[model samples]
Target: MAKLLLVTSLNKSPSLLLLSRTPSAPKLCPRRRCSSRADPEYLCRSIVPTMHYQKSLPRLPVPKLEDSMRRYLNAQKPLLDEEQYKKTELLSRSFEKGIGKELHEELLAQDQRNKHTSYISGPWFDMYLCAREPVVLNFNPYMSFNPDPKPEYNDQLTRATNMIVSAMRFMKTICAGYLEPEVFHLNPAKSDTLAFKRFIRWVPSSLSWYGAYMMNAYPLDMSQYFRLFNSTRLPKPNRDELVTDDKAKHLLVLRNGNFYIFDVLDRDGNIVKAAEIQAHLKYILSDNTPTPEFPIGYLTSEERNTWAVLRQKLLDNGNSEVLKKVDSAVFCLCLDDFPIKDNNHLSHVMLHGSGLNRWYDKSFSIIMANDGTSAINFEHSWGDGVAILRLQNEVYKDSTENPAISPKDMPASVDSSKAVTRLQFQLNNVLKEGITKAKDHFDASVKTLTIDSMEFKLGGKGILKKYKISPDAIAQLSFQVGFLRQYGQTVATYESCSTAAFKHGRTETIRPASVYTKKLSEALVREPSKYSPDELCMMIKECSMYHGKLTKEAAMGQGFDRHLFALRCIAASAGRSLPDFFEDQSYARINHIILSTSTLSSPAIKLGGFAPVVHDGYGVGYQVQDDWIGCNVSAYEVRDVGQFLECVHKSLEDIFTVLEGKPVKG
Candidate 1:
């Protein structure tokens, strides 16, 4: 039976039609086809006759269509309203019942933020360092399962995440020192050039802003990052405009209130990506205002030096020192679950004694494949590689499937001795070996976006949507993402490209006059810092010093030279040749995904940032995924618990030493 709903407007006439979920074709009616051309139910339901009238839908004319729609609305209005009323009543009843029950909820009220728990402080987090803008992370839902979350399981995921980011977080002090005393000056419109366009660089307001909204539907297999903001939308429009003496162009908004502006070109280089990225960033600024941007320099411009090459970008600039201020490191630990019944006992044993560690009593995830094997995934935000893996080993060593096996089976002091011995040493030496191996394996297969011709050919045309370009902008970003994943073990995000006058000191700033140069720039640098970049970086910028912070004297060169350097710095940073910080162990390279539209195009770039973990006893630890792009940190550590503890100790020591601007010999 069709459910009834009361709606003042005709919008609710058909409950099925009223639904706003992604539309899927309806299932076929249950009745089978009849050779007699009629079935009793079909006749009673007015199907065959109704079909004739429904067919008229294809022949709609302005007046007739309007009249028919109104008549249809009137016909079903009563039923629709009744259905709406029923649903409202049902919803109200559920609400009242929930309030009346108030059993388990009262306890929850203790932690609730709003009504009863005003004095009870809720989960508070400062994502200012994690992003250019402050972002809030609420742990309530994850922490508030009907049954409490298992400490051990949470520990593991946190540990893995932290391990993956240790090196970058560990060097913040040094990185911050190198980041200050530098700035990128956005050029103002020149006197002779006219005040037609404005330019700016893109920065993200939140990490989720870049991962979720800015690069919302890019090609990268973002099944992972999307989870961070899958259901998130910034609710902010991304658009801006630029005006130069020659013409006005629109821009797009990027992560940090930066604006993006670009021009159409025939090249496969960073130029196109840069232009598009700048435009999109600009658009996000100015509230998606359809303004214009005046052209400046070729987007493919590359300036290798500034501070980014040496890991300065990772520095906090004294912004928020949560990670540096932490006295102890946070660690998460988890063990892989093999279906063997023994493994179940092993999993349980891992939870013993460490009062905080526990198996997720009732948590479960669906297995897309129905094979008998079960996969257990844990989440942790603390612990280094050494501590994490060693913990796993200990769990395995201590487990016994037989319930008959109890404390009686072991010496009275065994449990206490193990815990004490478990952390015998502070940190471990796992990273030394693991990172060496990871580098070799990773570098050999480093596949990222290539700024070459990216084309999508749609067969059997009459493609839906008003997009003129065949594959459209979306297809382009997707193609880039697909290419990156195939060759690289990372995620790609779109950064807004730029559209400003080429820096021509003391001269009337003018957009590039060479279409060929523009094309060459686009074809080669569309996705800079990929395995293959454009020749323009070679042609336009001085590539030698592209490796580190350009000295003040070097950066003080003429306008054209400075622009060349700036552009090169952008490309080199994107390409991973430059470090956002000095002591970074690995490189951080994010693909630039560009969107090309007829009037304006925007490109989105992804930045590597820090992830912090707050744990119960282990404390807090911060990690940076950009270790590969900047630092040479290993993804795993040795499996000795003693050694693992040592690494954490050393890392914390190093973090604080850097914060103090002095080295520690202990």
Candidate 2:
């Protein structure tokens, strides 16, 4: 369960923080000097530079202590009985008037001292780094790309080659300060146009943010973009540190538990020929090297402290230079030996593979199955989904639209044997035993998890909008109803809301299990015959309205979770006795999170998911499309995931029926 908490703490889903805008097609740079590479025209240019607005972005605000306490008490109500609620309320009131107020002032002073970054950034990083669990299923999550439209482009070698080239283009575009800034345009016609870009470019970098704000456009914090490439999270004794080296010109490739590397960039910072990359990958795929008897990659999946000790041993045995090369590579490319069988199989493969073929420490790994289906499983500590999603969108669009290599194009007539370097590590008996234990432990842990998915086609965002309802709210309501129908009670539910609108922002929690939802769930699940269609419809409208309010507040940094979490951290660091509010059983129960959920919708994403946050909880990665709702659910063997999904499907049907002025049939 502690591992589960770490997963939720870092595994945030894509949120409404970003507007639905398709990335424009890449255009050749006209003003900047071109690279010496053959494909010089691949470089893209933006009207405004990538980090222009970062200096002018507003700092994340800390909510008033009273406001946070009120919100906290409200969120806790649905999960507690009268007696528990009363006692929790008394404890909260006492702390608010006493020690909590003192802690709030301390947090504000700390925030003032750290004006360069968001108040939550350091504490959030500490939360992730301080955890000792293996990150595989605990702190890393996956987002898979939709298959290429042109079936031929889905070939393994071609897709991998094209993606690698597109990724480099993105990296170069950002590093050269030519990539477009990440902005959410409320009215694209007004703010996402050439005129807006022209006007904003003239504004001083220090004042550029005001121009976007005037047009109802928001410029998100792009600080995390730096970690997308040439970054890796290094394990340490009590904490892990993130390392990035932009000078490294190679890409790491893992196949059959073996490591390989080759330079993908030239001295001029231009991408190498795609043909050369294809040829090198082809050679590695055809190599018949037997799987290592003790795969060093498995050590990455071991408990953090154990892996840290083993890593020091590897260094002691003269492996420091090799480890540095692995850490500094631009990114990892995993060529999997197994083909995806179905959507569920794809989810499992991307979430956590056999544990032998993956190096989970890389900032991000582009994994291509034998069948050419691919996904990105990334380390969650350095950044959230916003930066990765942008990369995914760009890579998916560029690789499919402007491929650098085609199937008909033969690999360059260069000897890949001379270009690619296979990395070898000398392992002692202790390290070998550690790797073996890691493999077995990983195998045993993943065996207890079950993943299932379902697609509802009756109605979706479009239909719900006709009734003036929020689609996200309704999706959340369905979960509440589904759980009540299946398990006979309401539990704490979490939906992540991104605060990227602020400088160095991370995420805030949206507590979806509100009193409105509790009432509606009971009405629909236990006594459907007692209420008229209009009555039930009215109840749904209320729930949607309240859920929308929660979403907006969370997005605006007015939510209580982060504020309370920061205050708690401040209190604990004060070297004083902790407040009773922190020790209340209700606090533990609320944070336990039985239904941990997140959602992401994009043309680039076929599906995405994370492991359950608790032993008895469900991790729901959902998307509400125009005419359908899709969910990928994961849980341990303690819960019946299949039955839960069925109940969710039924819940959606019932909600849709009620919206159409019809009674739900039992």
Candidate 3:
């Protein structure tokens, strides 16, 4: 196997942390700007203006053929019965010695051609962004912030000011390249990294640049800024057409159910002061006007294919200029009236914005409530949750700790030059009906989901540390044990592990429920009394080791799943159909992912949740704190996730007891 290597442009800076990661020999930056005058932003920001962390970031590597083959065969073991496993094993062996070599060569050649980036960028982008829509709970992920504990920070205007200020400051750091990239310290022995530098740059816009809501795939030539602080103007569908205005210079703010817009950046392109932003938000809240009867934002939550077709119909009526206001806006900011401390209410509002109050297509939108509560409703098309979550966490940190961000420090004045204005859309009868239909679709969709927020007190992660096991692996194994107890077998499971270690790397699947895990689960549930404490300990250790290895491989971009996916994509790109092995029923059955999960651990974030990718599956996002593990489990009506989580909680407790050398309970 090739050791991870990083080569950089002369302009790139060396990361101090990366140097620390491999301290014996350090690579120092050799080039510096020779010009007499430096960039003004660099001087003002008091930070480096280069991608220090990304300079030596390793390129995604092609795994050894035999290693990947063995891993693939092992991954499929848990999901298949004996007969199915044998068939999959046969198929795996055939591919390993046959067409798989050709595919591997093609992947290596592509990686060689694109030395600085991952091989999966183009295919992943099409799959993430332009390929799908309706863009609600399915693809779009959301995070709800903890309520402001301090009364002063709870004021909507005050909080909104802090948020905008913090965001501006953060963006400045990102632009200046002063931010640190995430280091994947998988274990002490080996490590990988993710290029978070792209996260900051990619979270701003470009989700809808192709055609704001066109059903037809007409490629549009529009340059989108990933860091622009402007708003995306989602004008109401004109005669059934959903249009967007991307040329706007201001952010669209919604308060008291009415929309308002003001300049986010001044004429000189510097971020407008937070006081100016607050003044505009306050101006919108001051007036009591009847909320618009047509809340078109709800339409975005309709079935994707349904919305695509309706959006094209809306364009046929042709109100291009009005649509432009919506298309070009950077993102939407909703200054809502109510305090949302309840998880259910928060999830509802964040997932599907209050009917008339959102332009769902914008890549990012912050909904700050009057009581200093807030949540983010972001388009999943642009980037994953890590980037947006980082942004939110930073904004929250600044707001909580920085006294200068307080609205009390504002210069008791408003910017008359940056006046807030409401956008008017001429809605025809068809468009009005579209809004009605969209609401119905949204209501129906919401009714199907049930989200349960749960926490397990395993005496903190330190308990696992004592046993020298990964806490995450235990959590994943607990889910497997619980599911096996409930469903009697493992369904295809998807545990998302980040592959951001490479340039523009997204994620690779870590199939958590392996054959070893399934065997353990079956033993635990079916014959707990038959297994001795030492035997159970060994089984648990084996399961954790299996999960840990798979996780590290995925993070290192050598996971079997994405490599297989890449092969299939390569065949399609070459105008050839996928091989028969891919079409096998066992392949689809083993990859269905009935339990979709990801772990987001941070001291700051309380809960991070996303709807299940499949209707029958459960989307579980968990945060493992020092003493407890908090999980937000969401499922459609098809599954009893609430009960499922209860089983998981009990299973976790049981595992801890067993590990502690206690006799099995019940």
Candidate 4:
């Protein structure tokens, strides 16, 4: 779901984010360390050197024009009525014979120009960065970690310190080029030849792709060189007001409705142990006020373009110095001690700060609740969720490997003389009024969102295994059935399957609401009594297998949507009259994602996912585990999350019963 943005102003830290686990920390991969070079298995595989990954990786390929057009037409059929389909077909044929030929040739020319990167790179980059919308749930995605088991470890300071150490290690791994290259399944049947692809440019070669995915742990104030500072996204209008100083190594601590900064790196540019970090936090926790009269952070919740303008005005009106101090800090840590333990509530705070409690622009924030629950809220403009998840998986693993140090374990020379620096924002009456307005806007906007997180014990993965079906395919098919049952029609669905099978690959659209999907769901819902359980099961299998086939195609970078998007871009670039196909109602109808879904599988992740993409749609992040299936369903006031979850549950049960040869009830 991540696209690179090519803006000069560096807001996103192009790096891996974070992940989570409970008392027993989870491991991402079973291989503890690199196998012996002398081993037979190690010798069998030709491992490329880390530094040469880019050189070894192949460039993203352009799909055949005819193949893409055929798939595109087939995808549009289900979303359009017969009359609309006829019009779409006529327009599509005209384009295939006329303007499309020229555009394809132009695209080939553009591909030659950007031979190193894919044809979609530049356009994808603009789609993310050029837009002025605030990257919250609409853009930036987030995932909350399971609550810390040890009460002492749950302490905000303790958890934050541990997380930082883990983050440092993760960064070190990236720098050392030891991080494992991601491998996505292209086609399970042809898995031998299409095994793995090195997508991420570990060390970007040039400015064109340089800093495109650089995960800079933002710096604050530094006592030494190479110290990183935390960059803060100040609340303003029209643009993102970034406050960062390269010299800063101090951590920005947000708790009890206030901001504090303290050095996390020692004078020698090494991470201070958890004990010292905790000591600094303990001092701040004492006698801190629970509320702030003016929450300047709330100003960030305003519309992005508006914020850019307002921030510039504020800078001119006299808050530049204070803003600098707040901006130039290292990473931000929020001590959000909320009463609710629900994942939805935690997710809400992490995605969009709990009203003045966070500055959401930093690459990553340590969100620690008073109950010791923690998660990371990050800017999605830079890295994808997997990048961040890799870091988190490391952190979760380390939490167990190196348990929190005792106070006695702290060094005798630990500095206690330097007090935590409280960041003071010099807000005039006008800025203060703007903060009030921002708070109102944030509260009103959030009030309309409904998030429902459910962990169903139906054992979806196990059931799928019993029936020999792909978990992902079944989950998606379940969503399709649920939508049809709830809305009485198949809505346009966007399912993100990895395109990490090629160099610099991101994601491709796996449209879930297909013609076969509709056919199967319609049969299941409307004429349940008309067919035998075996007959219905066979039809469902056909739909799930079709989904699986499309998913594999999407992963291989041969999907229809991106090719169509590239064609549209090409036509626009050529200054040619847009084809009638582009203007067809079918185009818009199929592109509007009513059900934005993705399945992230990890036994360690208890509750993991993102919010809805559109206001009236649902963002369904489901974890299809072995025993049970967990989902975090988010929707706006227009769509009920609870109702959607109920429909999904009913659909899964109905489908599962049919597959199990059980008679349908009622």
Quote model 4's TM-score.
0.83
Q: Write the per-residue lDDT of candidate 1 for residues 1-666, one digit (tens) a residue.
A: 000000001110000110000000000001111112121111012111111111111110011222222222222222224664354334334432542123223323332434321111111001111111111110100110110022332222222222212211211211222111101112212311112111101222122122211221111110111111001111011211111111212111111211222221113211122223223222322233221121111110111121112112213232123211110111112223222233222222221211111111111110100111212111111101111111212122211111112222222222222111111111123322332332343223212101111112222012212212121112222222222222221122111111101111111001111222223223332433332222432322221121011111111221122122222333343555432221111111111111111101101001011111111001011111111111101111212223323333333232223223343332
Could you estimate the TM-score for every candidate?
0.16, 0.95, 0.82, 0.83
**lDDT by residue (tens digit), candidate 3, 373-449:** 77776664444433554566666766676623564655338754348777666668988898898888777777888
Estimate, for each residue in 10-115, the C-alpha lDDT of model 4 and write its tens digit.
1111111111100000011111222222321111122322233343344567788787878888888777889888888888888888877777888888889876
In candidate 2, what are the lDDT values of residues 1-666, reduced to their tens digit?
A: 222111111212214221100000000001112222344435468778889999999999999999999999999999999999999999999989999998888899989999999999988888888778888877787888999999999999999999999999989888988778877766667988889999999999889999998997788788989999999999999999999998999999999989999999988877989999999999999999989999998899999999999999999988998999999999999999878999899989998999888999999999999878999888877877677877887888888878889989999999999999999998999989999999999999899989999999999989998999988788899999999999999998887767778898877777899999999899988899999999999999999999877877877888998898888888878788778999999999998878888776777789788887778888888888889998888999999999999999999998999999999776
Residue 111 lDDT in candidate 3: 77
| Per-candidate local distance difference test | 0.18, 0.83, 0.60, 0.60
Give the lDDT of residue 491 in candidate 4: 81
Ranking by TM-score: 2, 4, 3, 1
Reference-based lDDT, residue 268, model 2: 84
Task: Return whichever of 1 and 4 wins on TM-score.
Answer: 4
